[model samples]
Target: MAHDHHEHDDSCGDECGHNHDHSHEHNPTDELVTVRDLIRYATSRFNRNKLVFGHGLQDAYDEAVYLVLHTLHLPIDRLEPFLDACIPTDERTEVLEIIHRRSDERIPAAYLTGEAWLGEFRFTVDERVIIPRSFCAEALADGLSPWIDDASQVTRALDLCTGSGCLAIVMAHCFPSAQIDAIDLSPDALEVARINVEDYGLQDSIRLIQSDVFSALKDERYDLIVSNPPYVTAASVDALPPEYLHEPAMALGAGEDGMEIVRRILRDAHQRLTPNGILLIEVGHNRAEFEAAFPALEPVWLTTTSEEEKLLLLRADQLAA
Candidate 1:
């Protein structure tokens, strides 16, 4: 499936070959289309224009349903049943407009709906933060749990650059014994993170803070410090899709070479990390650049099924020299 609407001609009408005028349409009841009916129509429009990727139409349709249901505060699983039951004409029209925007504008569903899921957690999101896509969740779920030194036990953990607080909440949930800090430079991004933390009832366990890296950390140190910082080079960012433009630039670009942020983090991480502490950072496709820049630092590359991910693990001891 393709999500590019430019693939088809606009002259084609609905299968009936009748061009229905969209103008002068005010009362949605005049168009008593069901939710399923809207979904079918949207899917057809998407398919006709080739506006999605492999599974694009399906994904877009699902996203459309989610956005529509979210607008009405309805549960996603119950959307179909509700559609089959009785959807007010106004509601159907409202949902159709959202679907049309998604299908025609090629806007990402996450941005369209202002929400996304990380693990079992749903977060309120927008262009202020990058969509939650951390492989750290894999490490947490797999119990690749970091190690702490004898002098310092794993009492607290910090998720630096905590976009949407997904990682921070997950850390709090995974390590109930430890206090979690979700720190970010952007206050706007932190707002989204705060919602997720509260939504998961991890407010007591996780604290949201606004800080540029270790600036606000002061004398604070952690047994486990993880960050999926901005590692995209300026060139790469420029080449990204239009949808990527919707994300915060501060959450994406690091520098000309993309290592500006990562290098600083690696240099200063040892100071903030307790002895034997570990720091995991996702470099995406910039792993080679990172390795080449710091040959002396032998960071462990995390293996994942995701080809685009290039996560690296570093120990505080490794930086002692």
Candidate 2:
């Protein structure tokens, strides 16, 4: 089951590596191709192409394993038992093409597979929306028990700019009694989020509204509000990798300093939150601007395994002040 880890350069302007030069014509019995071989070849291609990996995974080895396993419909988490298994010739061709597309076209694996993971939660993602990778998901999974005085007392929750309804759905699971409202501007993104909400069978618990920020709400207040709003500056949006460009620009950019929508959120959050209600928002490397924008309001930065002090938590009193 040894695999050749040769570095493959497929950037040659023409034939895209679909046609194998050698006579290794995928005769399974003749030239055996195992899962190990696929992973090694894919890893080589990924490294050679230098594909950016920030959507759901960060390393070549894990991304390689995911592409191979996900393409073949094999178990992604448990790969040890399938390493030596031979890939069916028909399926091998598809997997090889997928890996090639990933490297040559620079398409994200999440888009290739149409799924993403958010803190042990699986979501249906597509180009209609950004791939779900949020520090907010991690904090929510921790039950927000670290900050909320009594987790059970939280009855209403809001997910602003809720892409794919991932946060709203997860909140429904964490707080069964709490009613949740998730809003977004794009009808297409809401179409995708609607599907996710139905897939999770949370239609009764999480309500989806098509709106730009708090415009769609009048007097509805929430005990807890979590948002992963568009905080990427215009400059940052221009500098983002090709994979990031695959997502909708509306989901990434806020303004020149990436705080336009956030400022509006702060403007009305004091009225939207109940007494002692909490707010959690992810700013992703915009801490400097955040600190300068509202210096008076004390923001308790929340940390996750992904980033430190990037997700901010503020109380109603501080926001009101």
Q: How much is 144 displaced in model 2, in angstroms?
A: 1.1
Q: How would you encode candidate 1's per-residue C-alpha lDDT over 6-80 as one tens digit per residue?
A: 333322224421234577765543443445555566666666755543211245566556666666556665553
Candidate closest to the true structure, highest TM-score:
2
For each predicted model, how many residue pairs clash, with residues at least 3 apart or on different chains? Answer: 7, 0
- What are the models' TM-scores? 0.78, 0.89
The whole-model C-alpha lDDT of candidate 2 against the native structure comes to 0.86
TM-score for candidate 1: 0.78
Q: Candidate 1 — which residues are off by over 4 angstroms?
A: 1-32, 44-62, 68-74, 77-86, 104-106, 145-153
> How many times do residue backbones clash in model 1?
7
